[model samples]
Target: MPMRGLTILVATGDAERLHTALGFAAATAATGARIRLHLHEGAVALLAAPLSAPNDPARHKAGLPKLGELWEEALGLGVAISLCQSGLALHDLDLEKLDPRLEAQGPVSVMTGLGDDRLVAF
Candidate 1:
């Protein structure tokens, strides 16, 4: 039987791009699809703590929900989230910032683990 799986690349620095990528991955995994999400570049911020320096509530609230919310939703639906080691170092973040279910891998290693299926980049 053919395996149904997806590995999405989230390497953009744009907030919207990162959020959209996660949304797509979450949606796919919601339907019992096996999924892998790779976070790189500024996209690593998606797995970080909510902003504390302060910003416009309108911008933040509307642009995307807090990372915690997104993370929870993905975990609830059994999606696997991960980080790019290089990207994490560049952004000064660590595995503590990621959900326990998520992994920290090097470059495109996560995609390689997916074993030939759909691959989307945002």
Candidate 2:
């Protein structure tokens, strides 16, 4: 019952990093740890709706997840997907029009609020 908490800060991700982070976080839950995912920069597109990215031929042949699929999966697992204020604002993403999940994205203050020791910035 000693489950731990983990906060994953994703500043940016393309095809590769997205796949890895999703898998890594899902696997961590098996070790009895919680997860929080912070999104910023270009990474915000992963959850921009329809929850999918372009197919990687190699990964597709192996039935790996696409961008959107990976995000939906992580959400289903209860990882807190937070957005960065400055990052989104810089990108001109309207906070009011964003998905409900985007609201979880907050200022640096929220990051400081995590009590867990696990913090990964990618």
Candidate 3:
């Protein structure tokens, strides 16, 4: 049987890592595999509204999609993107400013929801 789904844990603040994670999520989701991308720690910033992609110009100039575009594509492809609740608190980010598409959840909730999905961490 084919793989059931994929769970990606993104906990870094690095732009390249975030870009890659979203890229994988979008691509995997396009292949019809269920995808859940959980953002914790510094990665939570990606969900903030008016999303910033520091490497966007360079990536765009290099003929690649911008990071924000990749994120939108992932959402369009049915990737479930979530943010860690404690990560918001730890970073002092205003929850109200986050992307509404994201499901705010705790670690336990995320873990319990991962039913046999392959896990990948970045």
Error of 3 at 102 (Å): 0.6
State the C-alpha lDDT per candidate: 0.71, 0.67, 0.82
lDDT (tens digit, per residue) of candidate 2 on 1-122 = 77778777776746567667777777776566777777776776554545544565666689986666666777777766777776676666676787575554564666676886477777
lDDT of 3 by residue, 1-122 (tens): 66589999998766678788989898889888889999887888655455557888988899988877887888888899888888788778876776677788888988999998988999
Summarize candidate 1's per-residue lDDT along 10-48 as a digit string, tens digits. Answer: 876666666677678788887777888787767776446
Q: lDDT of candidate 1?
A: 0.71
TM, every model: 0.75, 0.77, 0.87
RMSD of 1: 3.9
| Clash pairs detected, candidate 1 | none
Worst 10 residues of 2 by lDDT: 45-54
lDDT of 2 at 49: 46
lDDT of 3 at 87: 77
